[model samples]
Target chain A: MLALELGPVKGSAVLPTSSASGENAFRALFAAHYPFIWRQMRRLGVPESAVDDATQEVFIVAARRMSDIQPGAERSFLFGVARRVAADARRTRHARASAVSEPLGADTADEREDPEQALQGRRSQAMLHRVLDAMADDTREAFVLFELEELSRREIAELLGIPEGTAASRLRRAREEFMEIAGRMKATASRGAP
Target chain B: MKRLKDELPEESFEASLLAADAGGEPPEGPRRRALDAALRVVALGGGSALVAGKAAAAATAGAAATGGGGAAGATGAALAGWKILAVVAIVGGAAVGGAVAVTRTTDVAPSESATSSPSAPVPLARPEPAPPDTQSAAPPPMLAAPAPAPIHVDTPKVAVPSVPSTVPSSAPVFDLAGEVRAIDRARAALAGRDTGETLAALDDYDRRYPAGSLAREAAVLRVEALALRGDHAEAARRAQELLAASPEGPYRARLRKVIDGAAASSP
Candidate 1:
């Protein structure tokens, strides 16, 4: 069994489940993938307003399909769910396509890091989110998993359900697009500067 | 086309690639509430598509029954139910209009049909935070009548009276969920480090739900705000006091960290 640290949510307000072991497995699954799923939903362009619900929808879908999930396939499975959720979200509010993913709240966190670092981190995150949001869907998905998450091409291929060659091609396209968007972003930033 | 790829140093690009990921950080209060609400729904067997539908049958019926209560021909509940699994996913989040939605100007053209054209790239900055709307309950009435409401998941109120379908106007807005929204807004304020806004929001929260579920979260944030504003003595005192008050509190670690930080930073 993989040791997934559930952190604060291990026992926080656990709603009762029928099977003890099943609930344990579900919690383990939640522990393992909640953040990843949240991030993936944002990457796939679920607006922040709807992101919380979208993330929950993914998990609820997972809960309903819990039996179908293999042990190691959690993230990929969540990715698939995230994609569907994001698509629905975008369709519902195409205007929200330009929404910003808010920085994680610092209220509950350790503030050991300097406030300046935190601010810079937020800025970098904003830049990154913009660049990724501009890429075509397939390329963005592949690039996010492969480049940011550092999944192997074969792993990304498996996750995205494409041939490895297709995954590689998407990554290539994604990388070039990412750089182009990054360049444009930098140019845009420079232009906006007084 | 300026070869943006040419600008990326191999090693630097490798590092910066992951810089954007930031995947899997533990969620804070509002998000945690969302996750918890989802777990409650799923744990209650609302996870199945079939159950999600049955679970949302009332909301759907409420929408269909009412002519204008729902959006774009979609009632808030029905749209939420079918598209989002309803509050089974959005229970707590829905009440908090547009979970801090920040609209940024789009720099990239809608079409990525051609990559890397030398269109003068417009770098958009981060969106300014939403102006605090202390009294407004619904996200400033969406321009389009049918716009989907933000999902907010709260445990269903067993005691709240449900109006008949034909009379959808009688249904209450369920202000109980506002407590969560107040907490969420306070945190949003806290994130921007506006101590006054944070305090005022928390004060509003206190007035709204004196013995609310998120009191502890509010307290913790209050301490953080104090310290952030350089009231180290007050922050440390309050944190240590809160810690002593709830030695085994859920925020024990977080509280200790704040207390320690305040002490260390004291002049």
Candidate 2:
């Protein structure tokens, strides 16, 4: 006879046979993917504050659709939900930057390795932020989800409801635009350097 | 774009790329709390769907009983049952589809303080500590006491009648299933660090069933709620009471962590 492993199972151990069990499974799945869903929402152009609303909306859909989701496709399903939630948030003009850009005071800079490098880092970040701000919504989203989010073209296509080839092309166009903007900012900074 | 990507050292870009892939860290401060609250809403929707489905099923069964035809009625009833199932499936399916569509088009930016005001106040409660000895064979201290059962503060009086004595003449009545669900909801809310909904649910439970057997558990949860709301003084007092009431409570360690975390984060 085969021996069963004594350790606790990770992921969904109970089948969603009943509506209640299905709901529980859905909650477990959402909790497990909370960070991923949040990140995807951010990259898609959701603002930091509204990310919660978007995330909640995504899970609400997941709960309702628990029966339709394939047993093994929970992660992909969530990403799908996240993509839709992010899109809805975008429509409402609720997309915002994450909180990392909050201006830290000079006193908080005590741990820097070198002041010059730190200052340069801030400048570069500012320039990058500006460039990101200027990109069209689709191009920006494609680039962020592809490059920053590291999602494959196929995944991006599914999430955005576009063809894989379209996702790749959009990513390329976005990268080109981002580079052109960044180049101008860098040259301008070099010329003005003391 | 190439130059910009190159301008930053590969390491920093790589770090950011990794963080982005990991969805970055949880939003800090109020944003994090808000996100947590949103997640609880999602979890609640899941529970709600189940309830709705059950209601739909019951309605369909009642409809079947009223109209009995020959063999045709049996076939019609079967078809109706299938139709009900289909409707449930479609509603749930559409919800998931909607969520995906929303996530795709949204542009995530940090909201201006003005726009984000409504979402910030929602996640104020912390999670309640789990009962001690949940994992081990040892029963919880409350279970051993054999004392008078506490009244459920939240339940309707008609649904759950009051017991004449602390030790009821009948068997000990415990809604283990509902308690389990409440516990799960509480934990989910806590994990998101959403204090508002967490506290609301706890308070709702208290009102619905005034003398709940889990009153001590709810009291322990109150401390976490106070802590999350930045009421450290109140949190400490409640934590002390919890410890005093159940010195060997399983959740002592976790409660201490909550206290420490609250202290560290205090301005």
Candidate 3:
């Protein structure tokens, strides 16, 4: 249940035609979407180590189907491919380990006098990931697109092929769940428990 | 902690944390590697051999295809070796006479030899961005052909007609891809120290693209081939002619290297 951020492609709308134009257009597409795809793959539950491979897998699929993708729909097309790639990687990792190890745990209490200072940067990110990992896949996906990526509700609905109202409801549920869990975590950190 | 009050919206409450989470750009190393891999796979006609650790090979092949970035010493050498076969592919497909076909042949052929063979006898000699002087360089004296027909790569009427094999005799439309392949072959042949073959390839390029856009690249390769072939006097003369034309040309550094090499190697 990873999140996707499928921002609209900007400027160029050059579709693949001849080999030269096709290759050049592909380069433009790659430059525009590489970062978004990389972050999306990470949030989609792909482990850090396998993120590069998963990202490459998504583009490889894109390259093969470049001619078939409609010009304005490239972003959504790539997100769909990224979603499938993340799922495959997650399944593979799940099979390899009896219990999937959480990448960064937020349970360790900081020795620093200021608890808020301890959770500012990397720890904050880790806590976010933990909360994301705890939620149901669908809710997390909607939450991620809206809350983290700042993609509009309409975009998320189009990306997920769901009605706009459905996307809104899902985001609401995800927000409440996120707040409840984050509150509990904040309380635990303040208590200074190991 | 007050930021997370019961009434506060989740978006506003976590704005700081979300910014921390998503603010950074993706790591350049993985982005580069992933791009290199995608370019290689595409060049390979979407082959699934996308091996994880083959970044080095993919990087060279990627650079070659896109004409972007510099290849490392070893990869540059390998690219040089493949240049010979790349030229041969061009010569074989010479009758096709369009940039699209030439690009396809050049990219696919060189990539095949990209991995197993990693070095060649000749050193660096790549086509740089065409300077204004080079871009407007006159057609070669040897070409009896009329001025090149203007390429309409985007025109629906002439945009890669189905039968590429029949198009050349009527009108030779040279584009960047064809020019690149021609230069790559000449450069490769010269790198392999087969100056004779290099000159032959250049001659073919001249004939095919009399008013070629990459005349400057061809000129540079021709001079280098002559210098490497022990034709120091002719090489020096041609290099001087090029230098005199555009003293501040993009190929100035490369031409100086050629002159220095010619001077050092002459008896």
Candidate 4:
């Protein structure tokens, strides 16, 4: 079968020692940070239809710069890349309302059991993006790291390379803005603004 | 890092929205594509290292200020087709030599096809073009779609190439070389025009590295082998199935060629 013991990538003149290890590092980095990058793109105003492409753009940058990324700072480097990708996507793109493109064949029993809940989840997710999109990007980054990704305040500060006080204050401001915008959105939706 | 629900007294509108946000799972399809693209970059010996340096600096600078435009174009332009194929060929070459050395020492059977075949190895080399009706009339209903299906999806459950459980979701092992070797073995076999051997290499690849990073490459090679063996219809169907599943898949151009070639050659 495909399983074979992988020796060091030896005797490859085309692949320098640095790049071989870089490739290995790149794989591990991709595995670890892909979800974060994907979520960051979606939350940072990359429309749903474009999230995948955006995520690819982020990782492609990371892959190319694998050597420069310090061991502990991979997340920070990836976040930096993701921000630019999200920005680029938001700039050039038209708003395309995301369709429920769930893989029909792979629906788990849990998803099949509660279709309405699933739909509700989708709605809430869309709403959350709207509320987030209304916020400034810096505030949204702090909010995403803390609220959704569940990173500690110190970690968020480190990832964004800001003081803890700055990160916490940004998160606080983000929460206040979030509640305000979310309330307004609810009122508008209830009034049938669509 | 307490979730909003922990701080809030009750589940408010915003809290519910946050809850929904947490439930939103990132799709695996895109992740797989991203990985393939990244691996392609890595396999190219970090060809864009210089370009990425500039992009990274600009990205950081832009994040601090107003975001910059025009940074995305450089990396997109770097992903030319010949570079990718060169990476594949070089890595696959190294793998072929390595696999032979490892095969002698390892107890794993060299001929995976000698064991029970996963999908019956269709006698693709038959000279008589199997009547179209007869081919379609066969039992398993693979590729029932007028529209292409997703790459890792097996809707019919029977005919579709069994979507290996290891496609995505799990963190990939740091065996980029192993992935290259496994899929390259199949590529090498196909180079020899040994259809049976190519299919066997693929089966072995499927069995061993189900989650191997090069699963899509292996899938593409499988379609090519089928086509090479004169199983044009089967090749076309499988290519169509994979294309449907991953419209923007890595080997899209090659898969399109397989489908078009199959159509042109088939009765």
Candidate 5:
């Protein structure tokens, strides 16, 4: 019977000097961080349809820098990649937007087990994205890292390379803006409710 | 964590962030695409580690901020066809190669050689159907997807009753150099801007070694050649077909690139 056969590829330049172990580490990192990175990219404003590419982009960076990702900091490295990829995407969308005659596939819109719950979920996510998009870039980064990601303020500061106090202040501003938007959304919903 | 009150049960911050996407599970295509892309990067010997993560963070952010209006097509432009092809090729090769090595070790060292045919050297991680409950222990997000089906061919199972094994002795190891030579010749034709020559070279390569290792690279070249010949209609249609077939395949990105470039440059 005809079967596809495969075997060890040697002398290939892609094989890093410390490949076996490095590859294992890379695979582990990919598994653990993929979903989180996917979500983070979406939250950071990569279109949902493009999240897979963005996630791959992050890991693509990671694979190249396997040795450089300090053991405990894979998340940080990945989040950072998501951040850059998202920013780049945003610029692209703004640039050739006129040229983009059609909206992208966006996130998959599969019917969920619970239709109402899914509707609510979509609304919340839409609002959340709106709120985040409205916030200043630095403030959004701080808020996302500190609150959504549950990283400590100190960690946010370290991650964003801002001072502890600067991170703290951005968090404060982000929260205020978030609540302001939330209040407005609630008011709109209530007005429509009666 | 409470960014907004009354947000837990009905409007879970996490669920909104981490719900099962509308797509259900991650589509099977991109993993292969991603793997292919990664391999291409490795193949290019381009300082494999992603542009020094630390440096990339700083440099990319600054570049984006300044790139402004012109930064629109930066992504497709940044990763040229060859670089992407190289990365995906490496990852694809690695997956196939890893499976072979693993199977070889298992076959030679073990006693029950009857499980898989001696002649039918198994592909990487042949997947046995895992027990249903076995995967229950994993977290919800963990189930987004498993490794590419090809990579998981690790488990020896009934090799599909097929036509027969026609692989040559050296077929086990992919002839990457030869693959590279083929790609280089096509690329040369492409560079020389001889659309007919480029198309001919790509077609000849595909016909000669239908299952040769660099099949995707050949596809990328074909799509690119079609575009160069201003056969944008056929190019786009072919690319879309290939994309639907392998959405996450490494060649998809370059295929998309050629399609996008044609669109952008056209009236």
Candidate 6:
């Protein structure tokens, strides 16, 4: 069997030895935080399809700089890597968009429904989706990390490489924008009613 | 609004997150290709370096011997010894390297065969007719003088039948080395206590062989590997996934043990 023989290094516990052992320890740490790192990438707006490759790239960086990462801060380190990867992807997308002609929105058509309750549910979901879509990127990220992912503000700040206050402010802005969009959606629905 | 949130379901979000993170079953092609490429490069570089180093030393010794004619014979013998040492080193290194490469290639094991034989046919007995009433059948001819005592023989020449070679073998004929390698990698991940590598390796195995018999054991090991790496929640979730998928799987007991262990160890 062609196994990745880890010559002599042992467990996931961090050793006080040279950087080589530290790298192994960090590789171990990176494995533990993989899900979170990937989640951060997705929540930060990297498409689901691209998240794995981006996540792999993130870990490659992590692996390369494994020795430099501080103990107990591995989570932050991974989140930071995820944030950068997400930004890079967004930038690439933006560059492509600039180069190519604008394309029609390709959102899938809503499934056919006739019942009033089902219609109302669809309307609600649509309203929420629109509200989420309209928010600024940073605000959306903060809100998702905080409300959806249930990460603490401190963690969010660390992940975004911003101050804790900024994270809180972003969340507040995101919530307000969501409320406004929802209000508009509700007004439009009422106006359309018999 | 409350109903809408309830209908959306927290579990759905969790599922989406997991799906998003899982990306898909890993790309086996790329990983294997990359590993192969790396090994090739290493082998080539090592080979070149060995050759170059030997050539350089040989040239230096040759020059030294040429500059000292008085000690030429002794130098020539020493040079021959150096050449032998160099050849030994290069040959030994290459052999070891080849062995390592072969050991690294994960492949399948061989299978076994089957067949068996038949027995003799039995003679059926015919029904005897009732004694004729008309003429007493000439009194049965007095048994015809006992039929010459029926020349008895000692042993019957029974035909020992050979087994037919047409049946298919039921033995599994896949790469045991690959499975063992995968298990070893998982074990290494577990030893590192890295939840990520362990989960990734498990996921890789599962993706590559969804219906593999050893999948359940790998899943159980994944849970342990994750837990050892200090990711209790993910370990618990994975355990739940395993239990839900195959409650009666071979590794169910081990899965439960890992789950219990994780729970106990969780903060």
On DockQ, the leading prediction is 4
Candidate 4 regions exceeding 4 Å error are A1-19, A94-119, B23-25, B47-267
Q: In model 3 chain B, where is the ten-residue run with the lowest total lDDT?
A: B83-92
DockQ-wise, the better of 3 and 4 is: 4
Q: What DockQ does every candidate get?
A: 0.06, 0.06, 0.06, 0.13, 0.05, 0.01
Task: List ranges where model 2 is wrong by over 4 Å.
Answer: A1-19, A67-77, A80-129, A185-194, B1-23, B27-267
lDDT of 2 at B171: 15
Better of 2 and 5 by lDDT: 5
Residue-by-residue lDDT tens digits, candidate 4, B1-267 = 566767875546666778777535578765775676565545443322222333343334323321222222233233222111111122222122121110011122212211111122221111123312232212111111001111111223322112322223231222333344455456556555577988998998788766544455677678878877888899889999877766644345556766877777867
Better-scoring candidate (DockQ), 3 or 6: 3
lDDT of 3 by residue, B131-243 (tens): 32532232111100000111211224322222212113322321223444465556556545577888998998888776664576678768767766677778878998898
After the best TM-score superposition of candidate 4, give how far the Cα of residue B68 lies from its true spot, in angstroms. 32
Which parts of model 3 have CA positions greater than 4 angstroms off? A1-17, A93-115, A191-194, B1-16, B46-267
DockQ of 4: 0.13
lDDT of 3 by residue, A1-194 (tens): 00012111112121112234344556766876677778887677776666765676667556544432323344555777777666656665666554755332334454532346645666677667667766777887787777766666766765565677998888889888877776666666666654
Best-to-worst ranking by TM-score: 4, 3, 5, 1, 2, 6
What TM-score does each prediction get for chain A alone? 0.70, 0.59, 0.77, 0.77, 0.70, 0.65
Candidate 3 residue B83 C-alpha distance from true site, Å: 37
In terms of TM-score, which candidate is strongest? 4
Q: Candidate 5 chain B — worst ten consecutive residues by lDDT sum?
A: B138-147
Q: Candidate 4: which docking quality band?
A: incorrect
Collision pairs in model 4 = A1-B204, A2-B204, B148-B244, B149-B244, B149-B245, B150-B245, B151-B245
lDDT of each: 0.46, 0.41, 0.49, 0.51, 0.45, 0.39
Per-residue lDDT value at A154 in model 5: 58
Instruction: Report the Cα lDDT for residue B105, model 1.
Output: 26
B86: Cα error in model 3, Å: 26
